[model samples]
Target: MKINIVNPDLNELGYVIAIANIKDKHDTSAPSDYHWKILKCRMIIFSNSSILACPDKNDVKQVHIIFNKAGDDYDKLISLFVKFSLIQNGGIRSATPEIYQKCFHYTMTARIAPVWNTLQDNYLINNRDFLVTRGPQEAVKYCIVVNDTFTVIEVNAVKINLMLTEEEFLPGEWIRVLPSLNKAIVEDSYKDFSQGSKFKSYKNLRRHWKNIHGYRLPENESAYYSIQFWRGEPLLYPKQCVLRNFPIVIPTSQPLEKLIISRFVTCLTSKMANVLGTKLIFKLEDIQPEDSKSLAPKDCLLETQAVSLCTPTQYSRSQK
Candidate 1:
């Protein structure tokens, strides 16, 4: 493996770019065997933060790393950093060009797990004079440090957020409405919820809806309606979210199931909102169940009578 460092003489912050190359020993004319192929990779790092950016160009025999700070281990991070550098140097294949092109356009927020405590302590003490103190609540901040060999990257935190209770859903009587109703709510608020939108697929929408709102599938089978909130604009990427008022309503009468779902949603939403530096709004309502097509009371009745359970509050950081 060989490494090259490239510094673009453009920005004042002085972004540092590193590229890695791995030679393939396998003969190209030989039969398609694993032993014949060589592995090559690339990666990029910004001076301002620890987040890794994908390459803007492409080459053959490339590998891409999916950023998941919470779930990725130290070994995985090291592997990704190497590949990221390779990608930055145009040594890897460009399977997803859009991702690489948009990599640097957005900011990523991630928490430092306790596993990297030693690294975090070292960075904090070394950069103590440059640290900025905010409110009583400590905000978590991390930076990526490369070694002299330029083969490894270490994640270190200068500050951390105060631990807060996870948001959860409470047990209550929720109205059961047709899936069409949920669709209508989303379409009304977000123009991108249409056919050409990224959320056109029900399965994709459901997955993201559950992930963003903190709803989880039940352990056992049971018949019940579920209420979920859809916050943010209907964008292809959650990190590109602009609007933050979309709400999803799932009506369920099952007390036990509703309680479980509510608690899970609440806890997850609170944690996600805080981590993403977004505000959360909770709207609760109780009304007589009606037919999906019938407008006995009016279409806007719920919106007018909705009660706010959680008001939006700014957090210290936002994660992708």
Candidate 2:
């Protein structure tokens, strides 16, 4: 039950920027569950510079990006000539990215793996897609300018229009807002007997569960009866917003081990706090993208239910 971002001014520091309508933590009303009923209104902005894109001031929307961070790094090996495209989303409980093309300021990226020498199924499922390789353009590091105002984010089916990060490309990721300990899931040493195999429950998950630091996420509904809010449709915004950072480009190099043993880094809010080196603090004061319904807290709004993911009786809280 944590969510912080106090005294931020220096562009906004590192970055994660939020604006959720959050609520799809599962329960797809059951037809087979893949209909995704309501969790739209999103406005994410993870950073490492490449700043907000898609708002062609006069024309300059070029694509091809790939300097990846956050989530899966898997111990290095996908620098295939290095690109730098740009991008968004709703929720996903499971595969739904069929996207072939739709247009409106486009940018495509590709580099999935798992080909263990292709002995067919001998090395167990390994035939990932998207591998359109290319090289040279001088390997552009990062750059973006044109910020007068821009942010529309419709999320669900898709609705773009970004251009709000004035300038950034520093050494990002050592943000501090503190207050966060209380994560008990434990159990890690990585094992997997692989019998009926649902990954044998994947060794109980523990690539990073942080567990402590300052504090701030309460905002009504009694803080969800005292910790434990998670289902997955992207929650955690609780209140007091006001950020504007966009510095990024962390790569001193060190993280590697990750062949997929349930690293589960982010279901939107298990960002597992206690950070400093990895860089990705979250916030966005003045609430852009039309202020995102005031970021809720009309006293939790229950009877009428106008703000969820936490006040509608809790539904997400796993930043660790």
**Candidate 2 accuracy as TM-score:** 0.16
Q: TM-score of every model?
A: 0.20, 0.16
Per-residue accuracy of model 1 over 1-320 as CA lDDT, tens digit each:
01112211111111223334434332222111211111121112222133334321232233333232333332454665554333232322321323322332222211121111111111111112111212121111122222222211121111222111122222242221111112112222222334334344444444442322212222222221223334433223221111122222222234533443343334324333321111333333222244222221122223334321122222111101
Root-mean-square deviation of every model: 20.8, 23.0
Candidates' lDDT values, in order?
A: 0.25, 0.18
Q: Which regions of candidate 1 fall more than 4 Å away from where they truly are?
A: 1-139, 149-188, 206-240, 243-320
